[model samples]
Target: MAKLSLCGGRAAVTAGSRLLASGLGAVAGGERYTNNFFLYDCSSAEKKLPDHKDEDGLAMAVGSDTILAHAFSSSGSFFALTDDNKRLILFRTVPSWQCLSVRSVARRCTALVITTAEDRIFVADKSGDVYSFSVTDPQGEARLELGHLSMLLHLAVSPDDQYIITADRDEKVRVSLLAAPHNIVSFCLGHTEFVSQLLVLPWAPDLLVSSSGDQTIKLWEYVTGREVQSCDLSTSHRQDGDEDKQRFAVSRIAASCSGSHIAVLFDCVPTVHVFQFDAASRQLLPGQEISLEHGVWDVAFDASSGLWILQEDKDEVVLIYRLADGKWQRSLNEESMERLSNHLRDNWTLMEGCSDTESPFRNLYKASYDNMAHYLQKKEERILEQKQKKRKGAQQETTQQTKVLHPVTPSS
Candidate 1:
């Protein structure tokens, strides 16, 4: 017997393997249901596809399994997925799962991501065609078309979903605006090969990070089209002999919500690289590194709980690491513990007067403005005072010279 947890639910029970074969489905306290199925029978357990549909059937035109890869919005009101079957799919997540499909020339869908704020979805395909869809209305419509001739490998939307960043096999990373449809926006150019992974730092929306097959990780300012930093992981093990030179490759990248740190995982190696971002120097410093037995495929941080979730490629088990105590825990279930921990940690106040303080940079900017105004005022006063003193001195000197020259007698 194997136990499987429901999607967004806490209950877990040991059920016969038959349930697993039939597909484990769970609905998280709603009229809608989330079905976890596999694209094929041979699909790995870790790669199970998730399908979200409304049980009430308010919007029934979009059928099940119509999306290739989909993700629900934060509000759970809408969901976006890519079919890449000559058309893209945008559907609602409620009981009435109304859907809209956009036709495209790209036959193979590689990656897709949705914005957090607006009702928009960015779809990228193997042919490098990136399309943006707006789902504000029940009928999803194509809002913008970003022309690209290369094969897009990965895509990541900012936390606010205001920006969409795409990495292509043509060795280019593009940043586009979700709010402004006409703007293609910025480009991050440095990788000599195909980019394998793309991640946006949640703490800093302007920061775009990417890893490439060229054995390097590059950071960019997504708005200004500037390459901020680049880390060459290829030479990470230079001291080792040439026999194992090409053994390690970066598989995934994740940044903490505070934007204070980043984690990078390697394909062959079990170790995860933690890089600390220094606000003072604006640089990433090497931090503590941890190793596991299995190759890590993905890494996610629950900011509220201060926990890090690492998914391994070889197993279905998710390793949970606590940031506060540096302890390791295992969970085969998807419970509310993560959300609960986040709520508790977020509301806990360890020190008084710490909550209202603004960031140092903000305070410094305010202080600088005040000082500049005061300096200008004082400068003007000093100039006026000096002019008055000089005039008085000159008057006194002239009178004394007149007296010495016998002009005092005439005045008397």
Candidate 2:
């Protein structure tokens, strides 16, 4: 669901297979939040979304139409999204953007991914269960593929379609065979906090990258459950006199189409840390820290390897950065980019009735409260009571020893 909460407003952007998708939520007329989902064809500059009324001639459910999860197939031929209304909408994007099916899911979906073969779309709902729907049959049933003990936050399939990776709020990343999802391959388990995002490296199919509320990103070899590298954001990015700053949780993780760059956004933070993946060294070298004027909502790398950032700013809802000469430079004069920015700016609202709210990511961090002082104080009190009891016993023994001592002295 992008973990986007409806406070002032919410925006999320994702790019895959030459297609860019954005979901925007805004309060309308000081009442309920109305969300709009947009799909853009980056190559032809065309845009689309579901814009039809129901068969009963009733209006669309404005509040429940918020897109929670969306993705394009690896081949860019199909696109799918799961809305808050539990409607899984699939579109064929090859010839023309056409709605193929709109099936009802059992629960609200948190994440979804389309297979490279474009056969099925695996959806993970908040119920911790995964269901696969057929891509060819419009009237197909959603088959229960797998189940997790905790709520799943993200889902991804390997390039070879052999394994499916699932991340949950229990700080677990499980790798399972796609055909038999119950047969677990391995568990990539090192996160101390809730795992937020997972990305199977496009170039290195066996390696996996995951971010967590623990303020660290880890690279894992999923088949063997080996940790290749772990980078602590709290320490690696520390600046002068910023030691006391809150350890920011990772909100999103994205990579370029070439798999040479990785971008990470922190929850409620205005900075985006870009990493250059060193294939030879198998390391994530720190690249650029793009500081924004407002808090970032989401980020994605396009098919052309352009970095797109969606922010909370009403004036500039979207920004694009391109890599030039080993540095990221802002690209501001593209016509299609301007059109997208203007469309989003027009839909953004003041989002009245919901403000001053804490981030949803705050609850993911491990709770901490120490009672060691109280425990030590009680221990000291017990020690003092024991000493007092021993003192009283000694005094009573001395009182008896007075006569006993006189008798002993007489006997001596």
Candidate 3:
């Protein structure tokens, strides 16, 4: 299952699979679950659908569409999603949620970013290429923007729309000119593993926040490729497990519009770490740890700075927390929460085989193998065996000599 905070936190979207027992559905489901997309407007306490001309057909066809990446334009006036079908779907959200266009991508997309201009959307695919599509011209052909040697994990655009930031499996954060992507601006280097998430601060356009499989969240001056600060997740204490010794990849990072708060969620970990951004000191200070009853899937900070969480619980899949008296308290949009949770619970079966999907971060971790040490140990064993063989041969020779010398005595 996957979830995204959308429409500047006024809405959220969750993706899961629905079990299909038939031919095309079963083939589309493959080893993964079938895509069953749900979009909820938190403010209105209702679900929204893509206003496609053939809305009914779109709903039926989406059962096989596994969304690989999605992002909302900086202004939240536009939303975009890419799927395994190699299709990019754009939606306009200003007046009402409606499908703007559906275009084909070069390859299976891994990440997406919409420029602040709201005119173009950038898509990163598993083949290590980024493609640009026009938001204004729905039928405009996709243009090849840039290429990476490794699969791109995430993409972020500068608020000014001058620079495009991309993170890849090679642990590189690249800053490139939006107009001329071939012109490299700088590279934000330091992460030793795959960079999974990237966010250009909404409030501080110059500041870039990135998370990695290396178990660290880094802040960067993206334009200059300078790392500002880093928070290591290994040191975080979680009461439930030996988390201090365990390493977890940062799956999501979200910052409040006020720039005062940042929320981070570690993959497979049930706790959310809220960090206070000290603008005065230019520091990210540890703030609060909100432990959940079940494993968390995703987290986002709403426009009001409220934290919304999607977790593993079937009964309560959606959780919203607000800061009150310096503590994070559960704030219920009871009706809204119920509707969202029910939608997930009713289709929980679609998420059953999801555990079989290999986590991309797992391979990002450096593998340790001591080939030299094994070779040396085998060499030592061979030397010991040769020594024993020689000893046995020497003993047999001595026995033979004794028998030859004592032959005369035996005859007498």
lDDT of 3 at 350: 50
Task: Compute the lDDT of residue 23 as modeled in candidate 3.
Answer: 10
How do the residues 1-412 of candidate 2 rate in per-residue lDDT, one tens digit apiece? 1222111222234322122333223232344223334443322321243444567988555433556678777755567777666677787753345677778787778889988788989999887999999998966989999999888999899999999999998999999999999999999999998899999988788889999888799999999899999998886545458766565677788888785899998776678999988989898888889998776777877556778787766677678899988889999875545655665555443221112235657766677766898899999999999999999999999989897777654443
Clashes of each: 4, 0, 0
Query: What's the distance in Å from true for residue 164, model 1?
Result: 3.2
Candidate 3: tens digits of C-alpha lDDT, residues 268-377: 77889998878887878898899887878788775567677977767777798888898889997554455556665776765454432345478767777999999999
> Relative to the true structure, how large is the alpha-carbon lDDT of every model?
0.54, 0.73, 0.74
Q: How close is candidate 1 to the true structure, as a TM-score?
A: 0.57
Winning model by TM-score: 3
**Per-residue CA lDDT of candidate 1, range 19-104, in tens?**
11111133444533333221121111122223333477453242222233445565445544444233454544344344443334
After TM-score superposition, the amount by which residue 180's alpha carbon in candidate 3 deviates from its true location, in angstroms, is 1.4
- Candidate 3: the clashing residue pairs are none
The runs of at least 3 residues in candidate 2 whose Cα sits more than 4 Å from the true structure, single-residue gaps closed, are 1-63, 236-242, 349-357, 369-374, 377-412
TM-score winner between candidates 1 and 2: 2
Candidate order by lDDT, decreasing, is 3, 2, 1
Query: Candidate 1: lDDT over CA atoms?
Result: 0.54
User: What TM-score goes with each of the models?
Assistant: 0.57, 0.74, 0.79
